[model samples]
Target: EPEVTQTPSHQVTQMGQEVILRCVPISNHLYFYWYRQILGQKVEFLVSFYNNEISEKSEIFDDQFSVERPDGSNFTLKIRSTKLEDSAMYFCASSVGRSSYEQYFGPGTRLTVT
Candidate 1:
């Protein structure tokens, strides 16, 4: 079975700096999403993308955050300005359809803002 994959398993950046996290979701999936877990907190939804446009986004996905499928196989999350509170294990997930509850998640990219 195909699985989602993320780049730069870990990233460290200074506060206020920009960072882009990359991922490759299962090629056959139709819905892609970005989520983050702050330390011991629950997983929080950031944004969901479909057909080259944003399908849904949570409050956490403010102007500072953006997602894109720059190509046929790559999906990316960009944080315009990092803050200590932004540090977390960011996960990229994909599902076969919008209503599919079974999402495949990548190993995750750990982002640390200093």
Candidate 2:
């Protein structure tokens, strides 16, 4: 009965500021991912990480965005500069295997930018 956890459940920031969203996936999970959902939009995959390195990334994950596994249990996503378009609910997910495994998602971090 393990689940993902995120910090700063809600965040508000001015445009162009840097933001870091934190997540802790299920302790035994190996595959981690970052996804975002803009209001009224579909959930989109941004990046995936495994074995302390990035395994896959979408176009949405550009130079302005980055992900890191600072330690064994924590994963973080950092946005170098925030834009109005970046305002969305970011979700962290993890799975036990590369394919066919269920991905468990966190409650998400709602980011609002002005």
Q: Which candidate achieves the best lDDT against the true structure?
A: 2
> Whose TM-score is greatest here?
2
Clash tally, candidates in order: 0, 0
Q: What lDDT score belongs to each candidate, Candidate 1 first? A: 0.96, 0.97
Cα distance off (Å), candidate 2, residue 77: 0.4
TM-score of every model versus the real structure: 0.97, 0.98
Once superposed on the true structure, which residue ranges of model 1 sit more than 4 Å away at CA? none
* Least well predicted 10-residue stretch by lDDT in candidate 2: 1-10
The alpha-carbon deviation from the true structure for residue 80 of candidate 2, after best TM-score superposition, in angstroms, is 0.4
Model 1 has an lDDT value of: 0.96
Q: Per-residue alpha-carbon lDDT of model 2 for 9-85, expressed as tens digits?
A: 99999999999999999999999999999999999999999999999999999999999999889999999999999
